[model samples]
Target: MFSWIKRGLLVSTALLSIGLVTTGTDYREVYAEEPLRLSKSVYEKPNIYKVDESEYALFHAVLPSSTDKYIHRDVSSAEVYTNYLLQFAYDMSMLKFGETISKQIEKPFQDEILPKLSEVVAETTNQLTENEWKQVKLSSKPTNGSGEKIFHLYNEESGEDIFRFHVRRDQPPKKGHWFNFHYHTFLDGHEGHHNLGDVYWGKNMPPKWMA
Candidate 1:
């Protein structure tokens, strides 16, 4: 009876360990779905977005590359790109508001908040530069009459997953900029996203708009 009990306990512990390992791997795979690895050579053409002429025109105004002829695969990797952008935007919005809240709610943290925000912003910039984030011509493909195109920011060199920025022909411009860009953490090549929205920093020394 004692031997049987010991064996049962061992079996249960083994199963639990396996379960934990599997779960962790699954989570990692989800984020690594679309790694920034571009198998093709640099000279080889990159994919483009499938969009109509009007949409392509609008995309050109905002994005570095023209969406007139782009190729994009609707794979799990694609989601990774968009996911990065959404999360990045959320982080930035929170950081901006968090500082304000810290200042108002806990006056003691006011001194610490600005420094933390600055450090985060600087880290984000370093990540972007470390990754090969640059403008490149996209591959040619037919639009098939699709009126919209999606753009993704990726760094083939860094092999990091980033965020997605979209372009639509019908959508009106916001805050003067044609397109807005953003990214998440490690999953996203860059650390944060850029908002083309109106921001107020007040009449302080540097101003928030500079950020």
Candidate 2:
């Protein structure tokens, strides 16, 4: 009887140790399988608004290539080309804005915005197969408010304005900051059609004018 009791005690001790080892292994496996968490600062969505023609004329402006009598006959095709150009500008702006936000820098526009913009313009002009007629000129000015940067783009030859971009802080501080940008297309000489609405960044909902 004494021998049997001693064997039972030994068996119980061994089983307990095995159970502890299994529990520890399970815990480690769970920890290894856990997913990594990312902060909002790491990923930001591109908030782009559609070009409103009522506010600006560029949305309906015809490309120089499309102005030929043969191509102009196809009104729908001309409209499509115009829309494509506007979309292109919108896309490039969004890409630049997204990169700027990701860096989370205080004065990104002043530091490196122009060169980056120039690079984008060069690549885009090449892709469009456009000659120097479509070349872009960039300029910036300080706004009356603090922490604001306003940029303007124009046609290199005609000197007609292309677009205006404003980067500013939100009122009351808690709402954060964002970008407001609009595009325009030259009509005759000095006049150009302006977009009826502007695109905004960092907001999911459409702007008041758009809504």
Best model number under TM-score: 2
Ten contiguous residues with the weakest lDDT in model 1: 1-10
lDDT of 1 by residue, 120-198 (tens): 3334434443113342112222122222223333434454444332222222334222212222344343444433222
lDDT of 2 at 184: 31
Worst lDDT 10-window in candidate 2: 1-10
Taking all chains together, each candidate's TM-score versus the true structure is: 0.24, 0.27
Q: Looking at candidate 2, what is the lDDT of residue 178?
A: 47
Top-scoring candidate (lDDT):
2
Q: Rate the local accuracy (lDDT) of all candidates.
A: 0.28, 0.31
How many residue pairs clash (N, CA or C atoms closer than 3 angstroms) in each of the candidate models, in the order given?
A: 8, 7
Model 1, residue 175: C-alpha shift (Å): 15
Over 1-211, each residue of candidate 2 has an lDDT whose tens digit, in order, gives: 0011111001112135334222221001000111111112311221112223344333223212122111111222332333333333333333444443433432333224432333333333333323433344444232332433344556555665644544433433445334433223333332533322222234332232111
What is the lDDT, from 0 to 100, of the residue 44 in candidate 2? 27
